[model samples]
Target chain A: MNISLQTRLLLLMSVALAIGVLVTQQAGRYESRRTAAADIDARLGRVAHTLLLSWQVSNDLTVASIPALTVAPPAPDGKRLPVFEVTTFDNRVLLRSHDFPLRTHALRAAGPGYGNAEIENTRWRVFTVIDSQRRIICRVALNEHDRSLREATLAPHFDQPLLLGVPLILVLGWMSLVYGLRPLRRLSRELARRDATDLAPIRSVDNDAIVEIRALRRTLDGLFERLRHAVNAQRLFTAAAGHELRTPLAGLRTQIEVAQRAPDAQQQTHALERIARAGEHMEKLVSRLLHLARLDSGETEIARHTLDFAALVARISGDYARVACDGVDRPAELQGDASLLEALVTNLLDNACRHAPTDTPVEVTLAHHDHWLTLHVRDHGPGLPEADRARAFDVFYRGENTFGEGSGLGLALVRAIARAHGGHAGIDPPSRDGLCVTVRLPAAHRS
Target chain B: MRILLIEDDPILGDGLQVGLQQAGYSVDWLADGALAADALANDEFDAVILDLALPSRSGRQLLADWRDAGQTVPILVLTAYDALDDRIDGLDGGADDYLVKPVALEELAARLRALVRRSQGQADNCLRWDGIEFNRASGILSIDGQVLDLSAHERQIITALLERPGQTLTREQLASRLYGWDGGPESNSLEVHIHNLRRKLGRQRIKTVRGLGYRMAQPDR
Candidate 1:
């Protein structure tokens, strides 16, 4: 069941050639039989003519009655011979060969041309003719077994070619296939030799490869390139996440030390406040890091369903008092993964609320345009500078003047989830001092 | 002693500044590397505590630049990158000492004291004189067999003098060590602390030259 390509191809070709040889063998047998039949008819008619001529020279019925004059004798045995019977119009027998049937009317059903009848336990091809000038009827026949001997002669022509050519062609085909697949074998060997951490692009063993093999090499190289990039990205993310945690951890340690050495309740209370804030920030960072890591693993399936976008955003908005949902009352439906879409909305809203002014509310709007649904979230805080906006979607990329305690993963997760749903996320720099993020998804509502 | 604290994290920087100040140091904290480099060049500090990752500039780059400029202050690298390569590169790039993050306050203080002491040509954290013993780590001064209580200024004066046993320090240099750039007692108030140290450690312990500064008295021949 797990046959290699070479063996499979060889087996298929061998079967096809065998069938072809069998069909050709049948055709050869049929043609040999036909040709033998035709030859037998001609020979029988010639023998009958010769007998008539020999009889005409004598003009004596007794002389023509000689069995040797009638036909050649059976060779070495009675297995084969040309047998005949000369009869008058009144059904009187004039001459009968030794091999002629004893029973009367045994071959009478035979027509004048050529026909077959059994005589003396041997099937015969019979040719009968009436010599009008001689006032006699001549009947000639030879055993049908002779045609089989002729059939044997054709074996050398048909059987030899098939017997020899099949194996030869098969061998040639096998050799060509092996030669063609050599490049693939080399490619697999090269791949098998590599260590897991080696993401270097593979060099095909030879440049004499076919088009398909070359294409396969290019695809494998491209895949390795992508794997290398993903590995590097993972390394950088781990490093950033670890570095980001150090300060908070350091803050916790120093705060505890300060509290332990506090001289008064006031000093202790202040240290405790900083410790509480730092602990909360660390918790936020760790949870966001988990989300980013899961997304990076590329295993999360986007479970698609027809869900109302307006209700989902409204639900996420209601969780935070500072976020307001706009144009989400009636219903706007789209086909998307429910959980992933919810996360995308939540991240956008969280990002907006984090950066928004303390007094102002974050705004969310959903709009549908031709097969596309766009969601926009705006904040009235000091907008991201022109420089920091481009790399906002990069993991762990934060502006120097970023707002308080944003894990820098919120916008990155937003972009990731949106892209997972066959969409894109972008930024629109507002004229006023604010930032707005927009996400677009394909619209597939119910008919 | 005065210290320059260069770190970018808000809470960590705040905590370190407070902790070092509590350890009897005047700490000048800067959150940016470019600003820190400028401050280091234009000012003086007994030692420096630097974070490797900083905005606008990196601590390693600043260290290399400072070393290239022949700035001779002791620098202690405090970073979260615990890789051996990062440590090697930081040290080879002219850092006087290196430490990983989440360090204990006591350890940081001890290392800072050691760096500062070694940079000043003192062998260790302890300074010995004629019948007087000064311990930097414990911040305690003892004469013969008795512990002598001293004010913060008196301690600063004795520490500066003990580090440079025979060398003299100008009034401004001593004031900078005690109070960094912004605050200290009035200009002439340094003499008061010097006089008090001389009294506490015995008059033979400190000598003052006219129109110059103060130095620890050499041991009697």
Candidate 2:
């Protein structure tokens, strides 16, 4: 399940809001219940005190049948209205002023103070007082409806402020969250609507909130830069290849044309020779292109094995001896890909053969020191100019004196392969009378 | 010389046939690798010019087959793919030489001659004509016991021209042979050198073929 960023963030905010609201409601409810309990207890204490005062004043009224004391008529609207049965201290019911429901559960046996008890599914707060002079106990009790513990605890939460305000607060919280997240939402929408090539930075109103977004934009920009570079490199390579190819192709065509216009055997034969030379040039160019492409794309895997460099050089020397006026030195043994190494060696040897005088013998030497393998091919031919030396490593940067049928990617490809194997190629000043090329490879096997 | 031309393109094959026959070689051309292979099996030819791309078998494969069958006739492989690997592969597969497409006929015959001579392992390195014996090994010119004082570059150029006497040498060929790689005579350099050599020897010794190149003509009797 892949969740989008918005959905995950919204869910997190919603859960946090819900928990906050519920916790506030629960806390408010608990505080209200505590205050209500305290209110009821205080009211019971006051009622008990009032009843004790009334009993003390009645202590002198015991003569002549107690002269039916006219108790003040109950004022039903008064705040202090009391409802209770009067009883004697000696456990005798004196007067039942009102037939109170739940009379047996009233304050009759309660000792001069407030008490609580449940009677018939209802709870009551009862108060009792004792007058020693009159020897009477007066008790007062009230139905615990309005001032009841459960109602006092539960009522206010349903009243105007809390009941209405909680929902209002929750709605406000949600709206605020939505407003706060607008920038992120806009960024996402803008990103979604863009094409693959549009790698511009996101426009944001709140700069403080989008540090990560800026970092992400930087990363994307880097990727785009690299992609553009790769595309440019490929374009340049193709254009160079095409341009280089035209020379040989044109030569081949002109050779054929020349032959077609030839009036005699001698002329035709000469044209044919030129055509053959052009063909050879084309062949060299093509092979170099393939080798360079293979190296660049990493398509060529190394077949590494312990190679007897001496034997390989000897074989190459023997092969080229008929045409090579220059002699190649014996090579040393090392571990490397035989085919790639052969290419490297052959290219250098062939280059020397092409440049040197027919009578001059090129010298080749191979040696190993520590973990490094080195091979040197030197031609007594004119050495590369110092100015052109660096450019010589660049593809197609043929020297001014180089007139051979070559692709000019020889040294470039050799360098690429050597670098890939954690080695390097260099042009050393000739110890003798020619230009020398040095190839060095690290001893470690690089796959 | 009898030549077997193996090429796929009819226009190129036809052009080559006309050009080669005009150059005095008896030409037998095959349009595909299969036909070339079949012809090679059924008939004997002095030399074979094979094209790399063919219908059934490629020129490289055909050359390999011929060599494997112990055919000692020199095979020159022609290809449109002018890559180094292609050239090396063609050569490695038993081709005596490799050539790119759109070649001139005269150069082709000269190369054929060289290949034939190489195959026969001829000892003489000199082409003798007009009382001049050009020693290819020593890079010296001797005419009736008189040694020509030629510059190294001039000697190399005259030697190449002398190798194929009476034939036009393209500017590209002369430049490549003289300058080591085709750096070409920079700023009328080849013309200047040729002029100097002509003054030393004789103007009639080397003739210029207009718009084509320089050629060492046979003795004008």
How closely does chain A match the true chain A in each prediction, as TM-score? Answer: 0.70, 0.69
Superposition error at A83 for model 2 (Å): 7.4
Highest TM-score: give the candidate number.
1
lDDT tens digits, residue span A1-447, model 2: 998665676678668767866777777666676676666567656755665565456644443333333243544544334455556666565544443554574456566677765677676667776766667766666656645534454557645475676678667766776776676677677778988756455455454356876676666668777877887788778867885775567456755775867788887887788778767767877887987888889887766677776677767766776334222354455667887777777788777776676677777776767878777777887788777777777886655344334566888878877876668998995465668888888764435
* Strongest candidate by lDDT: 1
Best by DockQ: 1
Total colliding residue pairs, candidate 1: 0
Estimate TM-scores for all models.
0.76, 0.53
Interface RMSD of the candidates, in order: 2.1, 12.7
lDDT of 1 at A7: 92
Q: What is the lDDT of candidate 1?
A: 0.81
lDDT of 2 by residue, B1-221 (tens): 45788865544565666566555445677765666787877664557888775654667778878888999988887666677988898888888988876566666877876785576565566667788877644457888879988776677567667656788888766765554222654858888889998887688888888899988865456
